[model samples]
Target: MKQPTTDISSQQAEQLLQPINQFLQCRTPASWIEQAKQPQSLPILLKDHMVCELKAAQSAMLLIRRYAVDEDSGNALLQWLKPYEDFTYRLKGNWRDLADHNKLNKRMVPKSTKPYSQELIDKMVLLIKEELHHFYQVLEIAAELGVSYDRITSSRYARGLFTHVRTYEPAALVDKLICGAYIEARSCERFAAIAPHLAPNLGQFYFSLLRSEARHYQDYLSLAQQISDTDINPRVQFFAEAERALIESPDSDFKFHSGAPV
Candidate 1:
């Protein structure tokens, strides 16, 4: 396969990362990138990345089902996701079969007349579709590179943010969305940060994803603001700091979005 051009300069990368960087409380440490860039790390990195992509889609699907859709529609959403979820969680299916399921229809619809519900449904559905496709692409890349699939433990990144979520209507949903924003933003930042450290083909692929990832962060933040009746900035800040702590702290295990080297 021909390598795609990844001629991104340091200045350009920082420019692209600036909005996300400013929004985030901390940067991915140099040591983490150093650890990730090693040839031995590619398999686990790609595996975790593939999982992360699927998880992003799953998270978005869950958000739409839980907050935006009717009971019947939520069931439909679960049915739509069942094939992919089975592949990831159960390891019972192959990623290639998702070719038929990737194109989404109107199976999931909003339950309420609340304007934000449909808006969220629309945005998150699109996100789910894109993320699932990215997951498939990652799998194909792994196959080409001869990397076998094995389930790995999730990093502390997401759980740390989840621990801070307030357990109340709209507040819980709002906090989840804010957390989603931070996750997406950090993913985008890390893609840029690590791209130059990877081989040409892989670096190019990661760099190519920056645009969609940036938009994903914006979509999550927009939905959070639209869903809440009150200012969501405070909650946003809360997760920003929480996310920073997760990234800056020492981690015993290394995975994508892992913290500082121990």
Candidate 2:
């Protein structure tokens, strides 16, 4: 697959990291960035970070359902996610319940003991755990800020990639994984891009996310490779083009994952 150019300059990266660091610093107080830097700010910054965690977990779950798991596992995955999705979309469920729900680990594998590999399961489990921890951290921050947990409308970022998923079986999975890789890569790039605009604490937080995001892109790509015997370069190119369109297009909504500022 064609790799996207990494022509961004060091100066540009530094500029981006500054704002992110500032954002983290200012997370506690309106002008915290200008004040003393302290360890106390971590909890506050982590509080708002929970949303990102949940979204990450949701993405991994979708991958497992669409590609790795059998039909029964797929249904189980949907059921497992119903509450979170409901809360996210404001369909039902109290947001507070998310805090108390059991963390997802050791997912139930089907009884068939088929030839299915556990690689996807292991990777996804770790991803889910990290995401939930991030979620918890964000909740803590929200609690500190006295910000009530409220459902917000989702941006078009995810839908844009998902819309391109093929309706067929394995092809659908291949396409989804390619899209997943793009999303993960984009997130990694954005974290690096936006870090400079943030405060010190925020910068560190976003920087910390880079490793996992990079790994996620690789994991998605690996999965795509495992499933397809044919060369996936063409499909990768197809999705890369789609992803670039989404990233470059004008989006009115300014979200963590949305395209360039409108």
Candidate 3:
């Protein structure tokens, strides 16, 4: 196959992804990219990718509602997400139905006067919007390829990272944000790693996502720092090592974010 010229060169990609690569413990194995490029992987990849995007938005919504927004704003946030979640979780609607309602209902109001609260709401709301748009784009790609949106079980990739989260107030939130950074970073890394090997249309789509995903990681890291009373380096290193293991280790099943094949 003639590869598309849309890909960033390795050096450029490396430079673009360096901040993320430095934060992660291990690089994705070339074997995973090889496997991901095969004809058989498209359906599951798109399906899980769609889910991941929606999950990203949902996670951002949760963060805002829990730590930033007031009760009414939180409720408004949920209402904003309902249609997308309903389509994803309940199979209640299609991409066009979602397309009809593209805007969030209202801006979130901070639950407190804390400096970080409004910052969190602003950054996360934009993140949520971008994520939902990405979700819709993935669905469009799947539809174009005649792939059905089958519900696959969640990958261990996210669960493994979440398990290490501390179970207390600011620590818990800090850890969660760190995990979010790792997740977004990994996604950006994988997008760059695999884009060159995909079909032209898919390659273009994946390439288009690199910038937003990179920003998402940076935003997560910044938010974590802003919310933390102390340096989060130790916590960041902990999650980096953990996420590295999750990516580099053998896995029994293939997933959008799964480790190298066994």
Candidate 4:
């Protein structure tokens, strides 16, 4: 199969991702990324990445509820995720909730045909499943390393992009889709940037994430275009600038999505 054009040459990807790479290099003290390459860094990175997976799943669920699903389906989604959220928020849940043996293989039923399309459902479901799988993988890595899971404060990256979203309903959805594109794009870019700096196992893992991340960005952009009747170039450009600003800014936190190191 021919690869998509979105999968740019490594050189092109490097050039496009330079800004984020530079920001990470500037913000992350050299000692940190270097240490992260070590076996000891595995526990911390794995634990944090585990949390990131849950957050990613949560984000996808929010999007599906907000834009794709009708009221009934939205409620169903909330119920489906309640156990995971309870655990994440440190609330007690049933033993089944804690077991981690349940697999997310069920199909989602749309409440309304007006907003929900099969294509949209398929893409979002795939994204949600992958995110959840990544969550499980991170948990496995953490368990292997004897790392106790703990919740930490979220970085400002997501909020920064979301703050630009319009307050109106559909417009807000459009803006959010654009923002989602940028987030996925940046994640793909970062996976490439940090891949070479990581140890063999980690390097392979980051590389493996790149193809999916790139597809995710394209999926968001495609959805935005489908929802909007007209061309979405302006919206894309608007969010690209916003994303670049966020990437270039200085931030105190050193998360996977944080700005330049301070």
Tens digit per residue, CA lDDT, model 4, 99-196 = 46334434566546546455666787688667666565555545655676666677787788889898985677778878877777777766675667
Candidate 1, residues 177-208, lDDT tens digits: the string is 99899999999999988988887788888887
Clashing pairs in 4: 27-261
The lDDT, on a scale of 0 to 1, for candidate 3 is 0.85
lDDT of each: 0.85, 0.61, 0.85, 0.65
Task: Give each prediction's root-mean-square deviation over alpha carbons.
Answer: 2.1, 9.7, 2.7, 5.9
> Which runs of model 4 end up more than 4 angstroms from their true locations?
1-44, 91-107, 111-116
> Which consecutive 10 residues in model 3 have the weakest lDDT in total?
1-10
**Residue 136 Cα positional deviation in candidate 2, in Å, after optimal superposition:** 2.3
242: Cα error in model 3, Å: 0.4
What is the RMSD of candidate 3?
A: 2.7
| TM-scores for the candidates | 0.93, 0.70, 0.93, 0.78
Count steric clashes of candidate 3: 0
Candidate no. 4 TM-score? 0.78
Per-residue alpha-carbon lDDT of candidate 2 for residues 56-119, written as tens digits (9 for 90 to 100): 7888887676556777776776666667667655647766686665355335563344233477
Model 3 per-residue lDDT tens digits across residues 114-213: 6799889888999988988888888877887899886678999999999999899889999999999999999998987888888766786787777788
